[model samples]
Target: MLDVLVIGGGPAGSTAATLLARKGFSVRLLERDKFPRFQIGESLLPYNNDLFDRLGVSDELKRGEYFPKYGAHFVTGDGRTEFTFRFDRILPPEHQRSFQVRRSEFDHLLLRNAAASGVDVREETPVTSVRLENESCFVRVASGEEIEARFVIDGSGHASLLGSRTGKKSDIASLKKIAVFAHYRGVEKPKGRDAGNTTIVVIRDGWFWLIPVTGELMSVGLVVDRDHFVNCGLSAEELLERSIAATPFVAERMKSAGRVTQVYSRKDFSYRVRDLVGKRFALIGDAAGFLDPIFSTGVYMAMKSADIAADAVEARLRKGSMRGLERYERDMTRALGRYFHFISNFYRREFLEVFLQPSNRFGLLHAIVRILAGNVFGAAGDRLKLALFFVLVRIQKRRPVIARPIRWEALPRAASL
Candidate 1:
């Protein structure tokens, strides 16, 4: 019997298994797909640097050829606005700097590190069923192999392996955008102070992301209205070309870009499961919930959630008490809720205006980034920061206007026409 059975090999499962293995626990990680596979969400937040170091794989992560992103740059219809938030500006000098890596390489590196940490990794063996029979969990793999474990972790990305089997999945209704992304070579990267910055370009309809991963390679994606794609009688490739062309700044940069991969698309990228934990099983990463990728917070949330789940499982196995499991749910919900609220508010124009306003915006962003750099967890501080930011936005909108007396006479309307 395995101490813990993790049903995915992505960031969450791998992190959980690796951490548990380091604690001298027997961990079995089953991944349906093999490593070195193509994946998306290539950007990494500086906050993840600490987690990497904790796993003792910081040297390996640093060895990958990656672009060092300092902060994010935004472009609205008016013009470009750059926010240069260096990790060193808020984090310790040793923990400063994050990388924009190619997901294929990054995920494989993490999985290999997990194996190196003494995890029993099963690749190309998909999970078919999970059952709680006779007070024990049994996992059935695609090869008709049955593996019993004291606890199970559902990290099967959107498959929601354990969550679905236990009827714990529910969709969040607010998010309704579709995403189309592709990798390109020879794409122009930002220069000088703006080098390695992720650019978010907002057009009339929706937004686009430009993330540079290497010297000449970049990942470009569009999050647009689903209906718009349906109305336009163009293939995904054509739509991407037209959309990029319409956005002058992005179009000019991709003039000589050659496609490195086919266009990949997914609709309704946001949803949350009703429950994160049930009995002996727990959900992680997209299996728990998935917000859009606009903020590049997916991978960070995944590994963080895994860390929380690993702690819970370790306590349960060692002391035969489920008390730590409850804390896991609370922490996961609190951590995810903070990001969910912040991302949900990004769609509102008034919120955007207040968020861009210098005084309140910069101060609040600094505080939150500091918390992330410090790896603050298991509390309401994250949520508190989000609430403060939103309150400032509301105050800006509700400020009463002062009436001023007009001294000039009114002109005739017909003369103007």
Candidate 2:
């Protein structure tokens, strides 16, 4: 019997399998799709650098053709409010830089690294069902194969294979959102060190993300409230075009660019599971929960949870008990909760006003920058920073300030190629 069975070949599964295999566990990882397949989440947070180093992929990532992202820039729809948060300002220099990658290449690299690390990785092997027994879990694949393992890990991302089977997944009502996106060529980019900075352009009903995936290619997407997007009576492509038109800075940047892929839409953007661990199994990555992509926390959360889950699994295997599972769940919940707390109020005008036109009162801007740099899961200092940030936000909310209203009418009309 395999010591561990990891479902899905994304960052979570690959990371878990790699770590466990490195520790001499008999691990098997199954993926429904072949490698080099297209995926959307291009921007990575700086914290991922540490995880990559632990996985021994930091040098490989550096050698890849991916764009180096140093920070993020935010601009409101009207282009009047804007601010930049360079990662170096708050995070240590070693953890201040990350990358914007083409998911196809990036994921493939990680999956391949798992195989190289002794993980028995099987591609195009869809897991049809998972059954937990008293002593082990049995996984059924489309090929009619049954694999028994001491423990099972669900890293199947949004598909939530085990999560759905056990009725654990629940949608986050407040975060009913849809994302429409595509890759583009020739999109205008900033010069110098800011060239790879991810640009977030906030509109009235949604926000746009512009990430540099490579020197000559960029990834552009809009995340909008589901109700507003559905009620717009526009196709996904149309909605994307309209969203681009609404964000002046994004419009100006893309004016001379052309899309290189078909527009894609993803719904039900936010959700959580009832629990991260259960009988002989645990969930990691999107299988456990997912948050809005405003801060580009998806991949970071996924890999971070995987790292924690691997530790728990190792402990369980050695002691024949799930001792560390509770800690894994607690740590992940606290990490995600910090993000949820801030993102829940991200769409509000007051938060945007404070964010885009930040005041350094109480060292609040630095606190906010630390969060943006994915430094929320660290020691006591990070917790204090987060608390200070929330206090500042509350103060900003109590003392409302009049800010410029977004001029929707001044936006350019939507156009096609």
Candidate 3:
């Protein structure tokens, strides 16, 4: 039997395969799609630098050409309220900045790096089902080939191959979100440090993301409530145009830009897979759970889960026991819970009121900066910092700190007109 079999060669699976092979475990990775395939989630978190270092792709990234994302700007579509959080302003993490990448390029680089580290990678091989019959683990592929391994990892991105087979995946009812996006060129973006900045253009019911995927191509997308989208009775392209036209912030930037790719609509699943850890299998990345993408936590959380799963898988290989598994679950749950809490409040006017108006009281704004920099999974001090920030949000609700709570008075009138 093989030591480990990783499903899906995305960030999570490839990361686990690379780390495990480096630890002397025989690893084989299967990817449903071939390399250089199109994928989304182009924006990355600041702390992904360390993960890149661990995967030994730091040199390739530093030397290679890619957009260096310094920080992110959250702005109202009208430009009345805005806040920018820079990674350099934070401490603790040595490398605080991240990169805006075309998913096709970044993912291909990671998978190829895994192969260089001795991971047996097979592309265009989709896992049909995973059967854990007693102690023997086997994965059935699309070609009717059965691959046997001592342990199996469900890193399948959106397919959730294992989660669907075992009926472990369930939807989160609260999050009914749809993302409509496409690529464009000739758009005039900010210069200097702001050149690589991702702008979150906040609208009344939804928001738009502006990311520079390359020196020339900009990835622009709108994320809105499902009801609001369906009620419009328009296609994804129409919705995107309507939204951009209504939002002055994105309208100004995209004025001279022209669409260069087909508009794609992604329904946010927000699905959770139960029993992430089992005797012979584990779900690492998107297969484990799907988080809201408002904070661009998908890549960071996926790689982090893979890093943790590698330790657990290594322990299981050495001790022949399911050790370190519980810790993986605990740490990921804690981190995801914190993010979910923060994301849940993001759509509310009360939370946005305080969050947009940055405050540095008692280092609280720095705490917000820390979370924005992807420091959610840290010491107890991290929790305390986030808690204090939420306290300020509540306090700001009752008594306005920087200004009165935004009534969006002019927005409704403009919409009606």
Q: Supply every candidate's count of residue pairs whose N, Cα or C atoms clash at under 3 angstroms.
A: 0, 0, 0
- Measured with C-alpha atoms, the lDDT of residue 338 in candidate 2 is 88
- Write one digit per residue (lDDT tens) for candidate 2, span 222-310: 88888877677889899897768665788899899999999999999699887789759999998999999999999988998999899
Q: Weakest 10 consecutive residues, lDDT, candidate 2?
A: 408-417
Mind giving the per-residue lDDT tens digits that candidate 1 earns over 222-310? Answer: 88777677776777777776777766667778889988889999887777787787667888888888887767888888898898888
Q: Candidate 1: where are CA atoms >4 Å away? A: 77-82, 360-362, 371-385, 396-417
RMSD of 3: 1.9
Question: Regarding TM-score, does 2 or 3 come out ahead?
Answer: 3
* Local distance difference test, candidate 2: 0.86
Model 3, clash count? 0
Q: What is the lDDT of residue 75 in candidate 1?
A: 60
For candidate 1, the lDDT comes to 0.75
RMSD of each: 6.3, 2.3, 1.9
Q: List TM-scores for all candidates, in order.
A: 0.90, 0.95, 0.96
Show model 3 residue runs off by greater than 4 Å.
Answer: 401-403, 412-417
- In the predicted model 3, the residue pairs found to clash are none
lDDT of 2 at 319: 86
The candidate maximizing TM-score is 3
Query: What lDDT is reached at residue 205 by model 2?
Result: 69
